[model samples]
Every structure is written in structure tokens, then in C-alpha cells.
Target chain A: MTVRDPFAMTALDAVRAFRARERSAVEITRSALDRVARHDRAVGAFLRVDAEGALAAAATLDARLAAGDAMTDRPLAGAVVAVKDVLATRGLRTTCASRMLEHYVPPYDAWTVARLRDAGAVIVGKTNMDEFAMGSSTENSAFHPTRNPWDLTRTPGGSSGGSAAAVAARFAHAALGTDTGGSVRQPAALTGIVGLKPTYGRVSRYGLVAFASSLDVVSPFAQTVADAALLYESIAGPDAHDATSVDRPVERADLSRGASVLKGLRVGVPREYFGDGLDADVSAGLRRALDQMAAAGAELVELSMPHTSHAVATYYVLAPAEASSNLARFDGVRYGLRADGRDLRSLYGATRDRGFGPEVKRRILLGTFALSAGYFDAFYGRAQKVRTLIARDFTEAFAKVDVLATPTSPTVAFKLGERTADPLAMYLADVCTLPASLVGVPALSLPVGLGASGLPVGLQLIAPAFEEARLLTVAHGVEELLGRLSLPSLD
Target chain B: MAIDVTPARVRATADLARLDLRDDEVGPFAGQLQKILDHIAALEALDVSAVAPTSHVLDLACPLREDAPAPGVLRDEAMAQAPRSEQGAFVVPQFVDE
Candidate 1:
């Protein structure tokens, strides 16, 4: 039963319809804008919705289509995509959801944004996120928290909460999200959408506001694995602007391969990821999904990542350390919000003090202490060594199996302000997603089933670096077996 | 060695970070910092003396772009985002002593 509303269409469907001329890009974009007008007040998924710009672009595409333009090469033709505010969009404000750069607009598009436009995708708006992509829940956003579409009272797990929520709410067909630790996958799991964090160097990070440079990667949130793969392929590639982007060409995935491809697939279930901390309902859901795969002819191997408990601790230390340095550039003189003071020193201090949020301030302090004159060896240096050990764990595990499976998050979407009082509890949400990030490998979060609270549970799949095609192929198999999770009732 | 997260140390670190903290923020930050540090102390149990630090996970080194100047973020375009600017230069409080 089609909902008749264009917002109900997945990006793949929308593109096919556009190609068939069943619906104009204007119709699809207007439907999404209407949905945003109706529901965004409660969901808070978007920081800014570019309705006029989106419609204008869509109208242009419609006009070209009317002229019988053969746009077969454009896979994302007329698909409305929401960009995480952290990415630079020319003329549009890219806030990073932080007060520091609230009014900042980039002169040039991020490499990915430019690529998206090149692929015939219309950017609808900038989605909200945790301030500087620093928090596990969108509550850290200076503007407001993006509520889970599944239930308004709960969080859409975050720093990519708004992006995931936008896709889940059908406000945007898909969205670009950055994962540093669990930002993309964690939120994707909670919101019941597919979120893929490509290998660290797979996607260009030129326009993504530096969070944790070493750990940061841009990915996509969509209803289907195919849509996610489409967005992933478009934005991922080598760029001269970002030297860390791999020099190799992007290896596109054959998403058309169905569940039969799972036969003889060697799937490993890490014993460490299923320890005491995992929620019982989530754990059960993951087991049931794995059993389905096993029944489908995929082999499951039990493995261990002994340093699992150390991941969150290590991530907190290293991410903050990198952030401390990257954030030094927002010193009021170059760009963004600034506060006046009597002297240069006072100006720097005042600007930062007024601009940065509590969470950001806390991280800067933690990072500052970690990299200080006397303690660098014990804190920052030690974390990097531990990082080497984590990478080695992935290297050894992949030798035994094609992919590793685990829970995307320890628990389902927690109530807003539930873990806000205790910061460590909040940090622990990233435990499952952090290990793969530290290793610079690819990871995808797919909705396996729902938990006791009626919210979704996400099963994470990890692959070796540059094995995104393999990762998505396996994900496509699982998605076929699991079927699509129903959209949440927004009333 | 036991990590000491004293209020004085928190104050000093914030100073080094070029951030000014309120009187109340220092105490809370000191407590939270100590807790996070204590958790991070778990790393002390593992001996990584033989392991080398990984600054970047990718095996990339010195990727230099063409030195040729192409039109980049124009001065006016860049200045548009600046909170305070004058005549193509970012305006800031004087640093050198008069």
C-alpha cells in the first residue's frame, strides 16, 4: 500500500519514478517539504530546510526532463538529500550545531557536497547534530535534540542524530553523516535506518569540520542498503584537498546481489561484543538475526577482541586530544563567533568561553590535560599505542572471517536526559562502534529487529579497510533476510 | 604514578587551552576529569612499551598538491564569515605592546 506521499518513497524508488516520468522532481521535493512542515517541529531533525532552493533545483530538473533530457547517468537524479550541518555547503550556513560557528557559511562546497550536486542530487537542508559532533545523543546540539521518530520522548542516538532522524521521518530521502566513534552507526541503529561509515580514508574529509581528524569519516543514512550504497559511491573518492583520502579509485558495490550471496559467507561473531553490558533484548535480537543468517548457509565463528573494554577509554582520550588542536583555529579572528576583550589573550579566552558549549569545553579541558607538558606520555601517547593494538586485533580477526558482527549500540534509544547527568554512561554508548573506528575499518549498522521498548535494535557489520563492497554485499544479504523495518507512526 | 586531577591542575590546563572558566566550573570539571582519567588508567595495565604510536592509520606520507595558485576562497567571500573585518584583513585586538 503506497502512502501516495512522495516522502514514503525510498531514494531508489524516487529515482526510478523520476526516470520513468511518473513523478517530477518538484512533486517529490514538495512532498518532502510538506512532511518537514508537518513533523519537523516535533522531530527537530533539521537546523535549516532549504525548501525554496530545493524546489528551484527540482523545477530545473523537471524542465530538463520535459525537454527529454537523457539523465540516465545520474543515479541520484532528483533525490532530496539532507546534509549534516558539519559539512560546508556554499552560501548555506554550516554550523556544526555549535554556537562557535553558528553564522559561518563556507565559500566552497565540501568535496562530497560538490559530488552530490554533480550526481544530480538536490540538497534539501542542513540537519542538526551534536555540537561539533561530540556527543552520543543529539542533546549535545546547542540548538535542540533531534527526537527519535520511533518515539518522541527518546533520543535518535547522535552526533548524526538529525541526519538519521531525517531519513527515518522521511523528511529527506537520505542524509550525509560523519562517524567519529559511533556517531553514524549508533544513531542509525536507534532510528532504524541503514548507516554506513566507510573506511577512514575512503571518503574525503575536506569540508567535514574537523572533529577527531584521525577517526572522522563521512557516511550515509537511508532506508535501504542500496540507497546508502548509492550515496556512499557518489561522495567517496580521492581528493587533493584532503591528503588522507585514499589515492585508489572507489570500488563500487553490486547492490543488486540478493540473499543467495550469503551462502558460504564466513561471518564472525566477536565474543567480546556480547559481554554483560549488552541489553538483553538487543542481544536476543542479534542472536535471532545471526541464526537466520546461519540457516541461510552463512558460517558463524566465535572470536574475541580482548581489548574491547579499553575502546571507550581509548577513544575519549585520543578524540579529545585531536579536537583540542583542530579547534584552536576557531580563535575569533579568522571566522565565526567572537567576543571582544581588552587584550588579545583575553579576546581568545572570552571568545572560546562564550562560544563553546559545556560538553565542548569539557573535551577541550580533557584534551588539554592529556597533551600537557608533563602528562603527554601517560595519556595521549599511551592511547596511540593502545590504538595500534586495536588495529592489530581487526587484522587478526579478518584473517579468520570475512566480516565481524556485533550490536551497534549496547542499548536501545535511551530517554532524553537519561544519561546526561553521568558523562561516562553517555560515553559507553560508543563502545560497540569505537573499535572499528580506531582500526580505520569500514562498519555498517542495519536494523535487525526491535527491542522490548518497541524501539529498533541494530546489528553492526565490520570489514577490513577498502572492503566496503564486500561489507555492503553482506549487508544486502542480511537486509533481504531481515526485510524492511516498518516506518514509525508519527502521530 | 597516580594521576592527580586537582582543581589547580584543571585551572592550569584550561589556561593552557586558552579557555576561561567560571569559578564554579573548575570544581566540577576537576571531578569529572579525574573520573575519566581514572577510567583511562585501565591502559596502564597493558604494557605497550614496544609498540609504536600510530598518528595516522593510513600508510600515507607527505601528499603534496600542485603549488600553482588557483582562484581560491576570495578575500571578500572569506571576510563575509568573519565576525569583524576591515579592508580585507581580519580585525583583532593588538598583540604587540605599544
Candidate 2:
């Protein structure tokens, strides 16, 4: 059956249709590919579209379903899943949007990618991203910028911009994104979709191109919180390949039980997140969400996270310090595109000089300088101390409140090229989302309302580490109470 | 404190990193590096003497598994994208002349 409204169909609905044989997996995959063909020219969501590979995978899924197989054995069978280019996929060019590895094709899949494949999710293609997952907009990509589906002139937030945009534009039912200082949630907020960055260690990192190894996380973006949770469950768990992967049972989030009023749930609104620099529209949207929660039987408690302001400063230092070490592997020797030169040293210099884009080189230089021997104690060391205080702030806040709420970003999607020239301003775009990353908290970004410019504003719900289930439940409640139907039509 | 990423420091870092920079690049890179260092110098202003350092977010301790020969990508496939290779291994010029 042809899927004319694939964007409206939820993940659960897609799975049911596929299992009932109402629609073949090939048809669904083709519909998504067709959408990509029509919209990706403007949105720039995908770096590569594996038409032949996607069709082959869909054919296999169709065969499995036709053989009268039990659908219960595969939770995500026949679903289309797009992965950010940062995550490695066997034989696919995983560029991470950097020219250094432009021609690189991995021989193995990342742990999460392998899990998704085992769950029978079709690997549609790799999406665009900021080089090394650094920038707040996908414009940092060496290739092209991913435009917001809501307004083509505006940016889809980055470095997971392409993933969020693809799902928002109906190019894929759901997509995987990496969250390093709000890459996943910020984009989800900008594009009016569900993005979840699970607690640190909750998901495996094996084979994912490293940016800041400690702070980076793989997350999911979907049209609904339940769909994001479904994708999250399939890829989260212990993996021998990733030492940081948590050895815990997957906490299944059941949103189908219906949205229950968050009675007796204590929601904390951090005073620091609502301070100066927050746009009037964002503040209004967040306040409206909080008011809805209060009316729905949840207690809105005024909380203080004094360390929130230092998050941006601390993140800039720590992320780069870690990046300096992690990115050292990209020298001319490894498997990737290399620039030729007369000798070994010249080869290394030319490879890095020509291969990396401006943003990537800037970050590498900053990181290297920060970690240099004389400056290490003054820069990298101080940031680490601030990190401790940031984490402590969350630990204390969670003791008094079950969840924390804030505006996902200070403003709606800005016009492309607005802040591209100003690196510091681009960094500030991640202000509200960075604290959660620093504290290793589970956070979800869901659309609250439309901004003055008619773009969607995101409200972030945060819970203590390993509390993804509670976070999703609280988000689901807020989503129902808002009742502001802001979903855009892709047709 | 005022600091400059001078040509001398650039050369030092490039040597440490084993990269050769052209003379023309040295001057431009030095100016760019100086501006970045100036921006990052803000970190030095924070007071963190009593606070404990946090390098990683997870409270991880010995999460490593026992040593075993786990499956890995084949050597040929792994090296397929390498720019220069010889005798089934990546080739680099010798660091020191014989």
C-alpha cells in the first residue's frame, strides 16, 4: 500500500500495518525514499541515501512477514531508521560531516547500529551533521546546511540537525542522533519533534566517532515521545564493545497507557534557566507549559540551580580538552581521505590542513591549546572542577524534585547564516541544554507551542540519571495538557 | 594576562605533533591561534581550588571486560580506505634516517 501520510503515522501504527500485511515493508521504505528525493534538496537532511541497500533490506523484511513469522519476536521489525553520519555503519561512508574522513567507510557497525539492525530496523542512510558534532547548527557541516522543515530559510538545529529535520520532513519514521551538549534535544526542539538524550552510560558508544567521549550520547528523534522511547529501548543496554554502556535492564516506557495527569508529581522550574537573554516567546511558552502542569495536578516548585550559568563556560573547556585527545586518531595514517605531500611530516600537515573544515580546525586548535602542558592545569583542570559543581547541583535538585523543566532553547530557529560568523553566539544557543549534559541527566525535548515567528518552541523535561521512564511519563503528560496541535504537514 | 601564539610556539606544537607547516602558513596560523588562546583564557579566571575535578560524568570503576579475542573487522577491509599502504600494512616514511 502507498503511504501518503507516513509523517502522521506513529511508529506503533507502522509496525502494526507491516505485521498485518496491510503494507509491505518495501512500500513503506520506498515512500520514505520518495519523500527524501522530493524534500532533501531543500532540507539537506541526508548526506547519503542508500536506495539499493534500503530496498534490499525491505525485501528481506517483506519475506519474513510473508512467511507467517511471529511479530512479537522483533519489536521494531520493518521500521525505517536513519542514523546520523557520526555513527559507524559497515560499508557506508560515515563522514561525521568532516572532510578528513570524507571517503572513509567503516568495516564494522557501531554497537547501537548493530542492535537496531538486529531489531529488524532498516538502515535508510546517513544524515548530515556538524563536523565532529561541535556546532549548534548543521552549517558547520563541511558539505551543506540542513534547513528547518517548518521554514526553509531557518536552520534545523545541529549537530543532529539532519536527523531531526529528516524525521520532521517525513524522510524517515525515526532517526538516531548524538547528543553532546544538546545536539539531539536542541534540534528536536527546533524542528518540533521528540528527542531524548538518555542518562550517560544508558546507551553504548562503541564505534561512534568520538567528540567528547564522556559527555557524548546517542539519542533518538521521533514525531512522538512514545516513538522515541521505542527506538531508545531497542538500542540501549550493556555492550562488551563499550565500557561505558550501563549494565541495567531496559526501562520500558509505556505511553499507550494514556496520559495520566501528573498528580503529586513535583516539577521544579530552575530559576537560572528563565533569566535574562531568554526570548519573550520562549519564556511565554515555558511558562504556559508549567501552568498547564500545575493545572493538571503537578506541583510547580521554584528551584535554584546556581551552577547552571557556568555550564557553557565549563563545557567549552572540557569538551575540547577531551576532543583534543579523541581526535588525534585522524592523522594521515588511518583509513580516510588524505592530502598528499612530499614527506611524512608534510603529509600529516597537508592532510589535516586540507581535510578538516574551518570549524573542525578551529576546535582542534582550541582543544590542543587547552591541553598543552603549561595551560592544562589552568584551563582543563579548572573546567573539571566546575563540572563537579554542575553535577552536584543536579544531585541536590533531584532530591527535592522528581523532574526539572526549562525552555529547550532561548529562541526559535534563526535564519541561516545569522550566527554562523559568530562562534561565541552559536555556542550560547546550547546554554539551556548544556547543564543536563554536564550532569548526565535524562532529558526530553517536546514541542510546547509555536513562537511569534510561527516556529515551534521546545520545552525540556529533565530527570535524574537513569530516570528516563519518569522523564517520558512527565513529557507525555505535558504534551497532552498543552493540546496545541502544532504538527506541520509534509505533503 | 596577555599572550601571543607566536611563530616559535606554533613551530614547537607542530614539531610535537610531527606535522610540517609551510612558511607561508606559519604567520597566518600564528595570528589565528593567538586569537583563540585569548578567547579560551577566560577559563583561567575561575576559582576552583577546593572543588574536585570531574573528567568523566559516569561514576565508572573498572567497567572493562576480561581480555579476550573478540571479533573485529578483517585487516584488508579495515585498511581498504587508507591512502597509502604496502605489504598489507599502512606505510609511513621512517622517522629517522638509517
Candidate 3:
């Protein structure tokens, strides 16, 4: 293979190289580790680097490949994959970027992690994230904030920022990220990469650490649309372990149509998404992408989602409410950090107080308050009902358009600590991406172009639930139109 | 009614969630919570009486599996993770004084 930088190759490309005998799996793993060793110091992307573990896995795969084993034919064989710490990896510390589980080692692999191994992913240790997947910026990580690879000073938009940064920095060909709200897509937008958040029930949540059980979906990050499609196909489908996982035939993306994927497609441009607070650069990028799709024979239909304003409020109340319930397991007894106390109640209180970070505590309290007896009807109940309205808005919109075109985040990557002081301000940054998560529809973010600030901006495509193949096909056509974006060179 | 999120209310909520908030944390927590609650207070203007609560986006019936005994997490493995384990049970603080 003439490719000098094998670490920068996409997952599909790396697999092809392995088959062609152009590169060995061990060599690819070494290259990935080398890059991570060099750049992750500055980016703070990974919480733990399993250099010995990765090499051992790679060596095993290399032996299997050399032995002409049929197992080597699976999609992601030998491709280095960085997993978000939210998912359990047997023997690897999966912290979820929270001090509560800083040294927690899962005895079994999460369903998705095991599937990735079955499909031949070389597990490169756990990545950093916002503590308990609760922040818009990775700064909420009790360990350290992961910087955007695009610019050292800016955030790689979180709570999956570490996985996003790892892929963008060429530490791995593909990485897994979990989306609850805009965690996956927003970070993908900030760092010039493709992120796909499948429908809530499409991927199993068996081993995933629950943030908002109703909203969380394990997603994938890759450099291009095709790689994302490949990664998603491997991870999609139902698992009996996760009761919510739907039993449906997984449809692979039809990229053979190439640029024709856009022809005769109805692309919805929601006016509510293009409203105020959108940065000029992001607006320009969206406009350029829309105009190009139109020129490629796609019909741009203007529409309105009136419930958009209530989405953030609905999400904050609902997600935190679920989080408070989900996170109740971290009491001092069964697993993770513990603080001794004179009494049982004090033991629970002291353990939780010292273990959780500020954002997590705030959410728990907010959730507790919302679900409390007196306020339940006012806050939690009202939010759930409004959630129905938001979902109905999407159901109605889908009747008019095949896919919705919008900004992934209203703005590009912001500076570290920019919104740390104001939690509400930080919450507002996720406005554009939250609605898709709220409704549990499939959405993907593809880089539209770099903004005036010289950072990448993304165009989000929202498809109906379980319509990932259509979403990927449309995104592939858009990628062809935008050509290739030059990723950040951390030289 | 101006619903002020007072420190007393903050401590009560924290208590419900089993988080012991220090005195220094209560003021800042109250203010932040108030701002967030106020922002979400915008949801109050809507008449959602006709709407139903959505617990999950997908319409799904509770999946039932055949009730058969299956292997569960091994006791050794489960016990390996507990903070304080005595014999075969997780040891908690003394629930009642002798």
C-alpha cells in the first residue's frame, strides 16, 4: 500500500489494506498506538491506553488472518476502535468520566463491545467523557477536559468528546460514542468527522451505562459517511439482553447510487432550526450545503416545527428525571467508590457527595425535585406531555419530507470554560440536536465545511425512526457533493 | 407565584437524592437550579392536558421471555466489585442500633 499514514486511513481502508497484505494488523495497531501516544497527551482524549492489551489483540487477529481463517472476513477486523467509557469493557476500566467509577472494572463486555469484538475490533482502552455523560463540554470530566483536535483552546463538544477527538486525531480508524441529547453529533460536528446516532432501539443498551434510559443510544464516529454506514451496520439490530432493541431487519446503506442518492429526495429545511442564535458561519455552511443538495436535484422544502422552543426544556426535565433514577445504583455498597459513615443514610450520602461531580449532582437534584410529590404534575408530567408534542412534530414533518436538514450545533466549537460558569447557557448550545434525540429518530452529522473561524461546521440530517439506511445514503450523496474535508493535522 | 428555589428547598431535594450538599454548595446550587427551573418554566404556558406522557419513543409491549433458570453473574465475580462484603452478602452500615 502506498499510504504512509495508515493511522489516518478509514476503517474500511484499513480492512482492505489488511486483506491486500499491504499492512499487518499488528503494524496498524502500533501505528494507532504511536499516534495516540504522541497526540493524546495534548488532547486528553483517552482515560486509559491499553497498549499491551491492544497489541495482544492485534497479534491474535494477525495470526488468524495469516491462518486463512474465515473469521477475518467480518467488517471491522483488525481496525483499531476506541470505545467511550460509558460502555463496559471486560478487564478495562470503564469510568464514564466520573470519579464514582474511576477504578471500576467491568467483568463482562457490554453487548455492543462484545459484538465489536465478534466483528473484529481491536479494543484500544476507554475514552474520557463528561462525568456521567451530563455536560455539553468535556470539561465536566473529573479527570481533565478533552481539547478539540481542530484547535487546542476549543472543546471537542461532549459528552462523547473523547471518542470524537480520538477519531479526529487518527488515534483510531473508528470509535464508538453514545448519544443522549447531542453528545455524539455535536462533537462530530466540532471535529470534522461523521457521527451517526441510530434510533434508540436500533442498538442494544445492554452494557451501556445509563444516562437517560429513554433517550440514550450507542452511536458510531468515523471519518466519512461510508465508514459510518459500515460501522453502524455492524452494531445495529436487536439484542434480547436489551428489551427495547427492536427486532427488525437491518438495512445496509445503498451507496452504489453514488451522487444519485440525492436525486428526487425531499429534504426538509426547518425554519425553526434556522431561527435566531445561529452563528453566521454555521448558517453560511448550512446554506451552502442546502444549495448544493438542491443543485444535485434534491427538493428543499421549507417547514416549521413549532414545538422546537419547548424541546430543551422538555429534555432537561425528562433526561435528568430519568438520570436520577438510573444513577441511584451507585450507592456505596454494590460497586465503585465508597465512603464509610456511621449510619446507612450517611453512608449513601457521603459516598454520592464525594463521588459525583457538580453537573451530575445538579441534575440529580433537579430530577429529584421534578419527580417529587408536589412538583411531579407541574414539571415532570408536563415535560413528558410536551415530549409527545415534540415527537408528533417529527411524525408530522416526516409526512412532508424524507429527511430534515439542519445545523448539528447552532455554533461551532467554543473555547474551553466558555459556558462552564452558566449551566443554562451550556444547555442552550445543544438546542439544534436535542429534538432528534427526544423523538428517538435516526440522525447523522456530516461536515458541511469549515466556518470563518477555520473550524468545521456540520449539517445534521434527521430521518424517521429505523431509517438509518436512507439516512446514510442521503449523507453519502451529500459527502460526494462536499468533497473531502481536510482533517486537523496535529503536527 | 414567584417560586423561589431557596436553599432550604435545594437541601431537601438533595436529601431526596441522597446527596449531602455542604453549606457552601447550597447557595450556588439554589441559584443555578432556579435559573434552570425558570428557563424550563416556559413549559408551563402550554396546555398539555390533552397530551399523554411518552416514556419511550418506540411503541413497545413489555417483552416477556420464557421463565427458565439461567446462569447469572457468578458470586465470586459479583463479590469482587462490592465495597464491603461479608460471607456471601454485601455489608451495609448498621441499620438499627442494638
Candidate 4:
């Protein structure tokens, strides 16, 4: 096997080696599992590691290859991918980073998980996540918090922090993560990787543990756009299991095409995204990134999203309200950890009391109150209206520009426990990310530069719904310009 | 309107959700829940009478499938993790006696 540095190989590179007979699928899978064993102690990226299962799957793929299968038929064959704990994998313990479901083994694989298996990809294991994907940082996870690979003292961003950190630490070639609000993108930014949140309904939600059903999306995190696109292609399609999945055809354009310039593309910079609370270093990095695009022949325009400031407030209300309802299933009756009690009522009470993490409880209470009879009109109802305004702002802007660009997060990864005591400060991390979620748009976060604290910053590019091709095209161009030298070393 | 979530309300809500809470937890949770509610309450100030409530992002009607026998968890495995169970069913205390 070509084991110069297992962590450095992309999914494509590993597949190529397996096809060329230079390495067997078993060798690549073992290398990946070995890397996880070596580094996961410090990174805390995975909650469960299926070393034997992954090896067995790899052996099967190797046997299939020996039977003379065509490479084109199984492009992702033999590639190892990590699944976030929130996405159910049949027979594998899917925790959703909460104690309530810690021992719950799902009966069926989530839509995405089935797709991955169909594509011949070996599942490495389930990575950690915030309980029910509710928090911006993975610290809200009932299990151990994931540490940033670049700097252990810093956060890896969150909700999908484990997925991002896993990919960053090279524990997996690619990882699937859910983005509700900023779950996937912010973590990608913090970890110096690429994360893509496809348009809502573009991917099925069948096996995914729901946080905010309307806003949540399953996406991919990888070192490059091509890798993310490859993973997305495998998982994006309508599913009979999920009514919310869209039946749209995948747009097949040459994503890897080298365009010397972006001359005709109109890149809009929302004035609201560049305003007051943005960190100085983040602003500088964004400006420099825009300048690079301009130099490469793209037209830059300053646009306005009038309802931008209200996005965070609307999201806080709407998301929690949905979360409250979706999480009602874990009542200690059907599955998972149950608290001891003498009576049924006490059983329910004690189970939920001990099962939920602090953040999950707080959100459940907040959401329930927001949707209550007396408060519905004032909180949940009004947030829905504001959501429409936010969506309209994006629609208006897209009319004038092909794509909009902004900083993925206002600041780089903060110190561990920095904003844990101040919920408002933590909510602000999603300020630049929530607008796109509100509108059901496709967005990409690509590492742009390092911040003053030497952490990574991401430049976000958003396109209209189902316009992932255009977004990927622009992101690829910018990524090439930025170069991969900017990637942080976990060592 | 700023609604103050007092300890009494927290306890009541806990009861509604069927979650047990200690005396110490009620006070802190009340304070934290009140702050969160206050943050969410800011939405009430906006005017949204003309805006339509969007429940889901999809434009398609809900697709219905005919009932069919499908592979599901075995009864024993399904109840394996349950704290209390009887013959092929989850066991719970009887709420009333005839």
C-alpha cells in the first residue's frame, strides 16, 4: 500500500490506488482505522469505532474487485467514510450525542447511509455531535467534547464538530454532517476544511435525527470541493422513505474545469454581513479573498439584506419550536436509557431527567413555551413571518447577482468554554450562516485564510436553491486561488 | 411582553413533560429558561399578519404509500433496551383499576 501519509490521501486518491492494484481496499481501510486509533484519543472525533466491521466490508470490496468489476461502476468503492452519530446506521449504535439514545441500535440505515453502502463505501464509524444537533459547539454533546485538531484548546465549531474534526484530523477521508443553522459550515470554517449544505430537500432526511425538520440538511465535509461533490452525488436524491426529499435531477457540469477567470459571474457581498460585530481579522480575510476573485476576473457588487439582523432571532425561535416537537419521541418508553422508577409517571420523569443533557433540556423548555397556546402567536407565529422576510431578501439579491459571498463565521474558533456561560454570544456565531438556511439555499464554506489567533477562517458562497453546481464552480475557483498551503497541520 | 419564567412555572412544565426535577434544579432552570424565553420573545414585536407560515420547504404534496409488510426489528431486539417489558410489549404501570 502507498502509506506515505494515510492522512494526506483524498478519497479519490485512495480509490485510484485500490483500482490500480497498488493497494487493496483492505489495506486502505486498515490505514484509516489505524490513523483513527492513533489520533482519536487527542481529537475525540468519534464516539464509536467499528474497526472489525469496516475491515470486513473492505474485504468484500476487495473480493468484488478480484471478480473484475469496472472502476466506473463503483467510483467510491473501497473508500472509507465516517457517519455522524445523528444519521442512523442499521445495527450500529446511533447516539445523536445524547445519553437517552446512547445504546439505541437503529433497525434500518438512514437514507444517506444506505446510499453510501450502495456506492461500496466502507463505514468507518459514527462520529460525535451535539445532542440532537442543537448547539453551535459540540461541547453540548452529552459525551466528551471534540477538540480542534489544529489547537486542542480551541473548539472545532459545532453541532457537526465531530465530523469536521474527524475530516480535519484525517481520521476519515470524508464525513457526513447535518447542517441546521450553521452546524456543518461553521465547523468546516473552524477546522480549515470544505463543507457544503445542499438546498433543503435536496437530500433525504429519513434516517437523520431531526432537530429543525425544515431547516436541517445532511451535507459533506472534506479537504476539497471535488471530494465534497463526490460524496454529495452519492447521497443526494429522492428517497421513498422521506417525503421531504426533492426529486430534482443532479446537474452534471464539469466541476473540475479550470476557468482562468470568473469574468461573467456577479458575486454579491451583503452589506449586512460586513457590518459592526465582524472581527477585524475576519473582515480582512474576506476582503483579501474578494480582491483575489476580482483579480481573477469576477465582478463584485455590494448588496443589502435588509432583514439580516432578524435572522438569528427568528432562527432561535423557529428551530427550538420544531426541536421541541421532534424530540418528544424520547419519553423513556420506546428506546434507549430509562431511569428507574416505582411508577409509570416517575419512570417518565426520571428517564427524561437523566437522559437529556443540559442544553437539550433548555431547548425543549424554550421550544415548548414558544409553541404553547398563549405564546404561539407572539413567538412561533411571528418567527415564521420573519422567516419569510429573510427568504425574500435572498430571492431579491439573487435576482441581481448570480451568487452572494460572506464570512462563514464572524470569528475563528474560540477557546473552549469561552461562550458557554453566555448563550447570546454563542448564538451570534450563526449570524452569517442562518440566512441561507432560512431560504433553503445551497451554500459552501471554503477555507480562505488564517485569523489573528492563527485559526482558519472560511469564505462562504451561497447560490439559489438547487444551484449547487454554480456554488461549487465558484468555490473551486476560489479554492485554487487560495491554494492548499493554508491548511493547518494537526501535528 | 417579557414573560418571567418562575420556579413554579418550570416545575409545572416539567410535570407536563413528565420530567422529574430537584429543588435546586428548578430555580436555576427557571432563570435559564426565562433568559431563553426572553430572547425568543423578541419575535413577538415584529408584524407578520401578511406573511404565510411555512411549515416545510418542499412544494410537493405529502406522498402516501399503501400499507405493506416490511422488515422491522424483531420483538425481542426491539424491547432489549427497554427498562421494563412484558410478553412482546413495553410494560407500564396501570393507571386505573376496575
Model 1 misplaced stretches (Cα beyond 4 Å): A1-3
Candidate 4 residue lDDT tens string, A1-491: 56576557888887787888877888888888888887899999999999988999999999988998766767688578999999999888999999899888888889999988888888899998888897888999898999998899988989999999999888888999999998999999989999999999989999899899989999999888888888988899888787888888988435665445377789999999998888888898899999988988889989899988888888888898888888878877878887867777887788888999878887777777778778787888788888888888988999999999999999888888998887767886799999899888999999987878778889999999998888887888787887763444555
Query: Residue-wise lDDT of candidate 2 within A1-491, one digit each (tens)?
Result: 54556556777678877887877889888888888888789889999999888899889889987887876867777678899999999888899998888888888899999988888888899999999898988998999999999999999999999999988887888999999899999999999999999999999999899999989999999888878888999988998778788898878775753446488889988899999988888988888878878877888889898878778878887887788678778778867767776777777777777777766665666677777888777778888888898888898988999999999999998899999766777887788999999888899999988878788889999998898988887787777777634566655
Question: Model 1, A96-191: lDDT tens per residue?
Answer: 999999989889999999988878898899999999999999999998889999999999999999999999998989999999998999999999
Q: DockQ of all candidates, in order?
A: 0.83, 0.54, 0.86, 0.61
Give candidate 3 regions above 4 Å deviation: A70-73
The worst-scoring run of ten residues by lDDT in candidate 1 chain A lies at A1-10
Ranking by lDDT: 3, 1, 4, 2
lDDT of each residue in B8-39, candidate 1, tens digit only: 99889989999999898898888888888889
DockQ of 2: 0.54
Poorly placed runs, candidate 2 (over 4 Å) = A1-4, A484-486, B1-46, B64-66
Query: How do the candidates rank by TM-score, highest first?
Result: 3, 1, 4, 2
Q: At residue A278, what lDDT does model 2 achieve? A: 87
Docking class of 1: high
Regions of candidate 4 where Cα sits further than 4 Å from its true position: A1-3, A259-261, A485-489, B65-77
i-RMSD per candidate, Å: 1.0, 2.5, 1.0, 1.8
**Residue pairs in steric clash, candidate 3?**
none
The local lDDT score (0 to 100) that residue A204 gets in candidate 3 is: 96
As a whole number from 0 to 100, the lDDT of residue A21 in candidate 2 is: 81
